[model samples]
Target chain A: MSHLHSLKRHLVARYGAIIAITVLLLEGLCMFAIRSYYVNTIEQVLSNRVQLTADYYQKYVPGVTPLARAQKLLSSVDKDEVALVEVLDLQGQPVLDSDGFIADYRHTTPEVSAALNGQQHAWVGKSPLTGEKILAVAAPLCRDESRDTVGVLRYSVSLEQTFRVIQRLYIYCLLVGLIVIALVLALCYSLACRILLPIEDLTIAAKRLGAGAHDVRVRQRSQDELGQLAATFNYMSSQLDAAERAKNEFLSSISHELRTPLTSIKGWSETLFSGKLVDKPNQTQLGLEIICEETDRMIGLVEDLLDYSRLQVGHITLSLETVEINDLVTEVYQQLTIRLSERHIGLTLDLQQQLPLVEADDDRLKQVLLILLDNALKFTPPDGLISIRTRFEQDIVITVADTGPGIAPEDLPFIKNKFYKGNSKLPGSGLGLSIAQNIVQLHKGRLEIASPATGGTTVDICLPQSTPWTAGTYNWTSKANSTRQNLS
Target chain B: MAKVLVLDDEIRIRGFIVVNLESNGFEVVEAASGEEALRIAHTQPDIQIALLDIMLPGIDGIEVCRELRQSYPAMGIIMLTAKEQEQDKVSGLEAGADDYVVKPFSPNELIARVNALLRRVTLVEQVSSSSEELICDPFVLCVSEYKLYKGEKSIAMTPTELAVMEVLLKRSGKAVSRDELLDAVWGPDYFGDPKIVDVNIRRIRRKIEDDPSRPFYIETVWGHGYRWHGESLA
Candidate 1:
């Protein structure tokens, strides 16, 4: 019933009354045509029968017969041999009855009325009293030397046989029509729903997947269009899940990196403060220096986190200044000298003399360089050559190259992603490149990472050439050294 | 000889300042707080310099500096600060203090700054007292080097203790205290107490006095006061 209500809603929109009226009109026309044909054929047969009776009378009886006599003659004829024969007087009294009906000549049927009006008529309907189906036709008969209104002669053939034949034909046609309609409806419903179901399922499953439930899978039960859509959804979910897993792993590794340095600083500072190194000046100084360096490293990591977050939220405000790239590189190199020396990495400078000052933050640029140089030193073998080169290609290009183990081609694409490290071949916090890239981006600069032909990795920082200088780049190491020299 | 007073809570720091000042040829006096420095400044008028530490146990250095500067305009005052934060240094300088040096500072730097302050104060004092031949605290003298020209009676003294007496007689217009005598004659850290300070007074009195026991060239300041008994040079 609810389905019917919905269907009614659809049918109403496409003109329900017009469709019903058209169906009713077509049914009425069919009934009219069938009745007309039934009457015409019956009238033809009746007229021929009447004419044959007239011929028989004319040939066998060589004298003129009165109307009453003709009526008697017609009535006397064998009823079983005749389909239906009836005579009515001009005063409307039945003269002869056939098919065992006591005919009331005063009563007028449509066929009789038409016949009395000098037009022949016939009709098909159920019999009222006799309960036998019949087709009736009527016409006026005239007799005598002068034409006069005589009586009506009516004929009706038993229509039971025609009715049976038509009934059977209609039943067969209706059965075939119903079967065809049923097949069409079945095919339409299956085709429409078959095409629609998987799309529906895909939409539902995709919605669930979007809500972050990875276990949702579309059923690919067919080799049809919707099945292909389901397959695509499955592939997308799998890809998303893989990427999510990789991100989780990267976050875990970052946490480990953050915690390890923190643990070392905490543990060693406690040991140092406990006076275990009271007599050991060298050890005490080493411990203090290590604690200071580790604290700096932790602060750097936190700063990287802040920068990354700022970059993610697009909130970084660059304090741009005209900077000498070579000077900046030298500052970072000096700061990292202890580590670089320990790694036995010989830094060769190829700075362009009188290179145009590029617009950048000297400190932030130094930070970026430190991260990159630290990474290079970490991955480079002892006694490997590290080189700093500056070039101008419409902009300042500062490159730090080292003879370290080169990065794999696949890892290069993801090397700048947060906390993404290459398979732990070398130990790293994995934030160096990512932070460097973010800082470079903040300066409206470009960072390109590539493997040198000989070996190791090269990072190129390209900065714009026309930003303003807001402050001087003061190297703390140089200041301390100068103070020491002055004191000495 | 110029008299200097050192005020520091730390014994080692006080010794360090006193030793440096004495080596630079200034007569040095030591006090550990603003109160002691104030008390010493009130009685011993010969103090030429007052070095104060900004952080002190009681009556902080700035207050002592202000009081000393008010009482003795010729006295040089230096404030010592520990932190390099500009606020501390500026506060010390703004408190009527002469100069400030950050602590953990080099001893040479402190001495250099002290000597520079002394010269600036001395030069200003020289301009104000241009006609005065010698400027010393008011005190009486009985020494061999100079005759008392106060109405023409020449005072006499022995050469052995005469040099000691001369240091006091130069400041005869003011009270010549015991520590000043001890610092000039026997040297700093003389270990002997106020007795040697009294004994030196007795020895100077015997040669230059009319009576040894009741001599009145340099009068004893019992408890909290001292005076020159002969006469005022003015």
Candidate 2:
């Protein structure tokens, strides 16, 4: 949970801050537009009022004096509409003021000068009299016959009220921006929690798994990538649990296997060490022979363990050579026929003549045949039948079938896994078939084990006719092997 | 020479055992499976000692021990269990094996345990004929038939449990220490945990007493051992 604090901070800093800043910038743009609209309405109204007053003077109301005209035309100024109205002589100085004071209006500016030249103009600045902000508009007044400028009519409506409206809108915009920022931040926070909570759950599960809690699992909450991640994590944990169980089973069985030999070796060595056979050389020779056999049995089991580990890491290197399939099968058959006949189990061989030479490891291929034959021998009862057949096709195929009780349907799938002995009490470290499969696969071959309901088990080995024994074909690599193992 | 039966599926281990036992002046009968062992025992009543391995093919050693204890009450049974089978050791005892030897054991250790168990077994046979019926109220021990009666109602008992009941009944009203019971029932050379006495005693109380939790016939003497109250409780 503490690990999520930094993530939360990063979320707020990156995503939340970005949303807030964007909202603020939008609000500022809106406020500027609103202010311009409001101020422009005020300027338009003031300029229209002052221009109409000057037109009336030029056309109809003949001025007695500019001061008298301003006083008379004050009613047209519409005091509710414009703040102050003034008339100026041709000197561009105010001669009359709407505040009932003349010659007190202080400045002559460009607006009044432009109006004297018969151009209407407007400007906004601080008033000379009151120092208050105002928008002033001016227009030229001319004689009716001459159509020439005589005086200027100037009008102004103070901009103070417009500015107040703009200020209030700015406050409203900031309030809306704050609300928007809060909403987006809340959304970002929830999104972050939604994502991180599963990661956190996976982290704790992984920790418990590291601590050897095999059954630990997390809930799948959503259909996003995180959900897939959770599903994948559950799969990984289950696999680890199964592997752990398999390892424990292996330990127990291996210990039993090791002890059987040790019991023999220790018992005989103790008797031999006790000098019990001093008068009997024949008994001593039997003990020595049994001791040597038990030692070889242990070495075989140890070699299987070494081979299994090497296969896992892809470290087993095959010495590739061109070998005759017929000769190989015949050799294995000869080696095993003696044992088979001793047990009274019958054997038959069916061979395809003139088999093609394939690139393979001679010793490893022989090991595969040995494993399949050893299985057939273990399962087959006395006077049962065993057959070895070879076929030639695009790939050379060898099949070994036994008349033993066939494998159960449930046990068939797991036969290639290490140490899957399936309720058989016969003695062997169950690594033989698995190692054989790995070896055959390394030679561009596959081992297919099937048990038919008709009461027999058959193992088929198919090797490609020609796969060049190159470094690329067999990857003796660090990176590629790891990925392959992971995939397996 | 004492006769012994050595049962193991492994041929070399069986041969080793046969050779070792024969060298030590005991005649040996060997069988490779539980069914063969039972057949051999049936044929030869003189074989008084049996050593069975637990992980055989058809019937396990525990079940075989139960079968042997039922019919041959005077045969000394020893189980040869592997090291990882710690629970199997206790189960083997519960199934009426008198003692057990772990795998990879030295021959001397095995021979010592066998000699010890022989004393207890022979003693059972010797003591059975000395009495026809040993009775204390509702509980009656039938020696020759290897049975006990609760007021004409016969109850089932394994050989180990019967041995404990016999010892406690003979020494009724006297507080017998655990070591004395261990020596008398399991033999002095018993290379096993002494807790087998408690297990058997508890089993005995369950058979005789109406309420085993508060046993009246068999009384725990608190840190010392146990005493049979006899009719004193009645």
Candidate 3:
């Protein structure tokens, strides 16, 4: 039943109904007008015929009997036009009949009686002689020049033929109307199909797209609204496909990256556990060192991945405070000094005498500084120069510059994107730069990288200057310290 | 001592393998890239085996294995692959690697594989020196020359394949159990799966038989092992 209701809602039902109603109303009006004209013309022609018969009887057969005159008049008139003629006396008694017989003597029609009173009259009624419905007209007849009525002359014509023609015409109009409605319905069905087919195709394509069939597209050749809609859908699907590919690539790379450190740790632990190095103290010491270092690398990788996931979910909370920029830089540099020296890279710190304190997370700022320094160390060759400098401008700017092979121009833009590793052969997980950038942004600071054409890279971290401490802020910090102590 | 080439891009891993292999009384040569590995293989004829890492800086391990297999058919090749990459192990084997040791593997497992491969090489060499050649119908095994010939065509075989063929032919018309073949080819000290015997047998059949599926010389003995069907020549 619902299927039928929907079918009726289509163009066939909607447009066809309008066309059918209009045709029906026009057909009815045409039939009514034709019927009125037919009846009126027939009545007028019968009245005139009756008057001519009365005149002829007075002029040509003055001495004849009234019955003979009536008979003569009916015989002379056309049978198709005038079906009956009658002559009645002043008392409304029929004297003559055109059929040469009378069924009743006192059955004079009202028109015939009115004619006997010397008034011409016409009416639409049944003929008494023929018993058929007809239009009859009656007129009075006088003798010589006297106005006294001699008898009444009446004429009537059958209405059956006019009614039959009108009925046949009505049937033709009905048939024509039906054909036109059928044609309109067929056109409407095709028109509805033309509009609905593309929409159906788009629905199927959208389902496939949702199912991860990213290459699915609808064919749209026309420059209409649906075509434009299809074009937009295609563009969106392509974008999703690219994003999915990038995600898969990142997952594979990250897995490989995570596995490398694991391999080292496992290999070294197994080596040391095998009891082969027990007799040699120095080898044992070296083995233990490698095991510890590889373990640290693995832990760092895990922490980096965890931080990236937390940042993705917007779950990172910072303990913000006023941190001296010089202190933060010095702490990170001191931690990385031994590692840099191992690579034969020199670290030079150029700190301004009066560097302003910045409002930021001190731990998170140290993390960013360490990430930048570690990246520079990994890329720089032996005996390379790395400089850490702090200066005060609109913001407290801390720059770490190294004489290393700088990033390629094309890879510079996407370096900060999560899991975007420009070179797969590198040892670190690709989330380092993105994580550092996120932390800096959380502090409302900006981090920028510049790779000079000559050959070196520099990373600049700018933090907003801290507002002067007030008594209220001091109380807030004390309360925060108490909360931290309680949690620990 | 047998010379072995250890190829890995990581200095620490290379150092670990060198220390372990050297402690086991094998001379080790290290190469950081595939190109260096190929150069060393070309120059050092005495190097009997190579432990190649699958992930290298240039010309990855699979390609290196293919190249080295073409140049030195007698040399043993063991691929060092990451445990999670199953496809790498299969591809390495398909590229003519004799065996594979997954990364994060125990040093004992690595040493055992190296010893097993080297033992097979030593056994084949001893067999070749003892007898100049071993013959079966339509095939000739030149033991001392380390070559095999079927009619006029020369067949290439790894050291493990040669050792298995030597054992099977010496005990002709006798079914050799997989364990016995493993003992004769890999030595008594080797602790590994006996399936290694089946893998070598399959490789040997592909090189020697016209139809490896139905071998004329080597035949399976129901539940036992392989039998040398030399009765066809009689």
Q: How well does candidate 1 score on lDDT at residue B42?
A: 95
Candidate 3 clashing pairs, residues 3+ apart or interchain: none
Segments in model 2 whose C-alpha atoms lie over 4 Å from true places: A1-3, A77-168, A211-213, A268-289, A307-317, A466-488, B1-6, B18-31, B35-50, B66-77, B90-98, B118-234
Candidate 3: where is the Cα deviation over 4 Å?
A: A1-251, A324-327, A348-357, A389-397, A450-455, A462-488, B130-151, B160-234
Q: List per-prediction Cα lDDT, in the order shown.
A: 0.64, 0.83, 0.80
lDDT of 2 by residue, A301-365 (tens): 99999989988788777776778998999999899889888999998999999987877788889
User: How do the predictions measure up, each by TM-score?
Assistant: 0.50, 0.79, 0.72
Q: How many backbone clashes can be found in candidate 2?
A: 0
In terms of lDDT, the best-performing candidate is: 2
Which has the better TM-score: candidate 2, or candidate 3? 2
What are the per-model DockQ values?
Answer: 0.01, 0.57, 0.46
B171-213 in candidate 2: lDDT tens per residue? 8788888998998877777767787788778767777889999
Q: Could you give the CAPRI-style class of model 3?
A: acceptable
**Chain A alone, model 1, TM-score?**
0.69
Model 2: per-residue Cα lDDT at residue A464: 84
Model 3 chain B scores worst on lDDT over the 10 consecutive residues at B82-91
lDDT of 1 by residue, B1-234 (tens): 788888877554564455456656888888977899899999998776677877665688888876776566446667776544567665665454555665555556666667655655554455334433332333233222222223345443222133355555555647766677655544453332344345445655654567878877677777533455544556
The interface RMSD values of the models, given in order, are: 18.2, 1.1, 1.8
